[model samples]
Target chain A: DTAVSQTPKYLVTQMGNDKSIKCEQNLGHDTMYWYKQDSKKFLKIMFSYNNKELIINETVPNRFSPKSPDKAHLNLHINSLELGDSAVYFCASSQGTGPLGYEQYFGPGTRLTVT
Target chain B: SQQGEEDPQALSIQEGENATMNCSYKTSINNLQWYRQNSGRGLVHLILIRSNEREKHSGRLRVTLDTSKKSSSLLITASRAADTASYFCARRNAGGTSYGKLTFGQGTILTVHP
Candidate 1:
């Protein structure tokens, strides 16, 4: 079984479209994170949720929203997508918040392209 | 909001050779982690070295952390062509709102030729 998985590994959409990416982890983790990798391959944290509670939110655009209905799942929704939104999005998870929680498990990324 | 700065940015080596990548940060950290990302794939955790720990080894991967210099390094012994990938180091602040958050480095692209 996959420890972490993301649906629709590749997504292509047009500008102004709305889309969502779903993430799930079967590792019984309490914390999950979302990261975006730009064309330059620079990875940055977009949001983090611990026990379904938002903990950290980077300076992302208002159009981007993260929702965690449960500790095992985190989803990203983008409204009115722009061409600049084309990049690889990754979902990650950890045991929880603490010193021993630094190690993270990542799922296969979702390659999103806004045409 | 501190990010790790990886050195060389890119590296190339032959099979059986060793590859080393360095990461330097601007602030103190509770722990440092190394992750490897294959082309068009998600990142996989490799090693984690805490502030209290100087060095750690797993399989052929060795990681060293130097808090005084705010830097850490990853060394892969006997590299193989399959080891070609991008490596990144992430740092966690000791205490702050971003405690559980990880600040990643730009990454080091390593090419190992057979």
Candidate 2:
């Protein structure tokens, strides 16, 4: 069974368009996260939600928003997609929000290409 | 800001040889973890060492931590071609407000040639 999964594995869109990526986890974890990997291969955390509550919000632009419908699902929506928005986005989940929660299971990642 | 920086950004080794990667972090951490990522894939957790622990081993992987120096090392013995991937070191911040947030390092790309 896949513990974590993401939909729309590859997305190619033009500038000024809007897109959304969905993530789901079956690991019975309470926390979910979104990370962005740029062309330079730099992985950075964008947002984190615990039990459907926003917990950590990084220095991301206002165009990006994350929504969690439940404890098991977190989705990312990007508006006015720019060329710089083209990057791989990974969704992760953990059991809790503590030190033991450090071990996160990541999905295969959704690659977004903006033209 | 990125908290960890991995040394030797890329490495190429022959099959059956051992590979080592180093990581250094800037702040206090509750624990440090190692993850491996195949091309165009998400990261997979390898191992984690707590602030109180010094060293640990799992299968052919060995991890050593130096809290004083704020650095760590990951060693893979008898690496196979399948071991070729990007290795990253991540840290769980010791701050109370930063729950479940992992700051990842710039990864080390390893290529094991068969």
Candidate 3:
């Protein structure tokens, strides 16, 4: 079974539209995170949630939001999608927070294309 | 706004050769981790070295950390064609409410030829 899985492996939309990507983990991790990989292959963290509670929120735009209804699920919702939003979004999960020797398991990634 | 930067953005090597990628970060860190990503896929965790530790080894992979210099290196020995991928270094910052948060480097693209 896949440890971390993301739905809608590919998404294409126009500007001013809203979209959501779903993520789930079977690792029973307590923490989940969302990361964006730009065309330049730079991976950056956008948000992090611990046990369904929002924790780390980077300097991402307010149009982007993350919701974790339960520990096993974390979803990203983007509003007013802009062309700059075209990139790969990755979802990851870990056992605990910080120095716990817990390695993060990543999903296959969702390629979002905004026109 | 990036904390880590990898050197030699790309590398090419023959089978059975060794490949080394270096990573440097600006802030103090609790640990440094290495990850590998194939084309159009998620990252795979390779190994992690704690700030207090100087070196670590796993199979054909070796990692060394220099806390004073805030740098780390990943050495892959006997690389094969299948080893071709992008390698990244991630750092866990020392001080922050975001303890588990990871800051990743630009990543080094490795091409191994048989």
Candidate 4:
């Protein structure tokens, strides 16, 4: 079974349009994260939620929002999308919360294209 | 901004040859992990080395961590064509509220020819 899954593998929308991507993890993990990979292949963290509580909110634009209804699910919503927002978004989940290393399982990623 | 930067952005090797990749990170880290991502797929966890550990091995993958230098290396022995993928080193933040959060490197693209 797939441990982490994401919806809308590909999204093509016009500028100013709004879109949402859903992520779900079945690994029984408590921490979930959202990352954006730019055209240069630089993966940057955008947001993280631990047990449904916001933990890390990086310097992302206000147009992007992340909602975690539960520990197993975290969804990303982008509003007023611009051409610069064209990139691949990934979701990941981890089991523990501590200084000790915890392996994260990533989703297949959603490729968003704003025209 | 990325906290880690991998050396040798790309590597090409023949099948049965060993592949080595290095990663360097800034700041204190609880541990460093190696992940592999095939084209058009999500990343898969390969191995992790803690700050206190020196070397770790899993199957054909060997990982070494040097906390003093804040650097790590991954060696894949007897690499196969299927091993052609991007390798990334991620650091688990040790301080602040992002303890368990991971900071990833730019990744090294490896291509193995049969």
Model 2 chain A is weakest, by summed lDDT over 10 consecutive residues, at A94-103
| Model 2 residue A9 lDDT score | 98
TM-score of each predicted structure versus truth: 0.97, 0.97, 0.97, 0.97
What are the per-residue Cα lDDT tens digits for candidate 1 across B1-114?
Answer: 357689869999999999999999998888889999999999999998889999999999999999999999999999999999999999887776674888899999999999
- What is residue B58's positional error in candidate 1, in angstroms? 0.5
How well is each residue in B1-114 modelled by candidate 4, as lDDT tens digits?
Answer: 457789889999999999999999878888899999999888899998898899999999999998888889999999999999999998986777674778889999999999
Classify candidate 4 by CAPRI docking class.
Answer: high
- Candidate 2, after superposition: displacement of residue B23 in Å? 0.2
Task: Give DockQ: model 2.
Answer: 0.80
Any residue pairs clashing in model 4, and if so which?
none
- Give the winner by DockQ: 1 or 2: 2
What digit string (tens of lDDT, one per residue) describes model 3 on residues B1-114? 466789889999999999999999999888889999999999999998899999999999999999999899999999999999999999888875764999899999999999
Q: What local distance difference test score does each model get? A: 0.92, 0.94, 0.93, 0.92
Could you report the Cα RMSD, in angstroms, for every candidate shown? Answer: 1.2, 1.0, 1.0, 1.1
**Model 3 chain A lDDT-worst window of ten:** A95-104
Question: How much is B73 displaced in model 1, in angstroms?
Answer: 0.7
Between which residue pairs do clashes occur in model 2?
A: none
Off by over 4 Å in 4: none
